[model samples]
Target: MSIDITWGRGDGAASVSTVAELDATLDTISRAHTEHLPYCVTLIAPGRGEFPVMLDICIGHPERSFVYHVAADGSSAWGYQPDLEPGPPFTFDYAGSPTDAWPERTRVTDATARQAARQFLTSGGQRPPALTWETVE
Candidate 1:
């Protein structure tokens, strides 16, 4: 299954079918300022219509980032947050704009984020089992 990965404002879109390609692409996209806007990337298994299942990652920093998943029909959306305890809110560049995730939406390490991305890609956009996902409010 091939997944289309689009970073920033869509200029870095590419399709990857294997884990290695995904890994390499992820590695390239994970770097800040790699693209015109080094904020986030959206992964989609195309041909599912306009609202396809999407896995998005905010890779503003190498060590910490955020993940979000959305169902095709738009019935559900989730954010990965391993820790639920309240903490300082995180602000990062998202699609070229500064966006903030709530304190409850804790940041995750790159390893954790990558694991979730891999799971999402392998499962064809299914909610990743590698991380704890809470419904987006």
Candidate 2:
């Protein structure tokens, strides 16, 4: 069984304001997964001015996944588990009102984000390490 964590920054999205911040976020996630054993973290490089920051985590044993998205506006955060049921895709209208499009993502807090990650891991019979949020510089 393997756990995979992936992260990516948006093109010019302030959600990850600096390269150092991105690296720190990657390090934190990597360290957290180390306790579970045999897990890998992948960082997807972002293009300049990307609109949304993305993070995805997958557990192979029970086969579960969690996806996270932070809007370019920094006004909202989205989390979804795609392995369960079909959900609406996230949308953004760049030409018009960017936030006007979407299936409407649930507003997320730092604690909720951590909780969701922990729950996903635990449901797969994996013990998740303590995870803390790192602010985007």
Candidate 3:
């Protein structure tokens, strides 16, 4: 299955089928952030039925991300706290929205962030087993 990736204020999203392709696209997103454009990478994976699972990743110092199961009943979950300090929200620009934010409690190191992304991609959007998660909203 292919995953759709989007970043910055662009409406266009790239469809990638392999981990290598996802990594390359993530590299581009990281470079964009390095240039001071705070954009989050959003990944959409095909789920069971109508709605697809979504993973939004804000890759920066204390990278942050969350996964939404997107069930038919509209329930969702988040990437739970992984022993990180519950610091203030890290604000960023995401798809034309300047107020997009993620809490530091959901933060992880760069390596951990990459691993989470890989897990999501490889598992076809399943909540990553390598990371702690909690059902919310």
Model 1's TM-score against the true structure: 0.79
- Residue 90, model 2: lDDT of 35
Candidate 1 stretches with Cα past 4 Å from truth are 32-38, 81-90
For model 3, the stretches where C-alpha displacement exceeds 4 angstroms are: 62-73, 100-105
Q: Count the clashes in each prediction.
A: 0, 5, 0
Better candidate by TM-score, 2 or 3: 3
lDDT of each: 0.70, 0.33, 0.66
Cα lDDT tens digits for candidate 1, 55-125: 88766454466678887776555555556344356566565566776655555666777788898889887
Cα error, residue 108 of model 1, in Å, equals 2.0
Residue-wise C-alpha lDDT for candidate 3, range 1-137, written one tens digit per residue: 88888776674579999989988887877765674645667888865666667776665544454333343345566565467765456566667677645564354555666777788889887766666766774
Q: Least accurate stretch of 10 residues (summed lDDT) in model 1? A: 78-87
RMSD to true structure for each model, in Å: 2.9, 15.7, 2.6
Q: List the residue pairs that clash in candidate 2.
A: 10-50, 11-49, 11-50, 12-49, 12-50
Q: Quote each prediction's TM-score.
A: 0.79, 0.27, 0.79
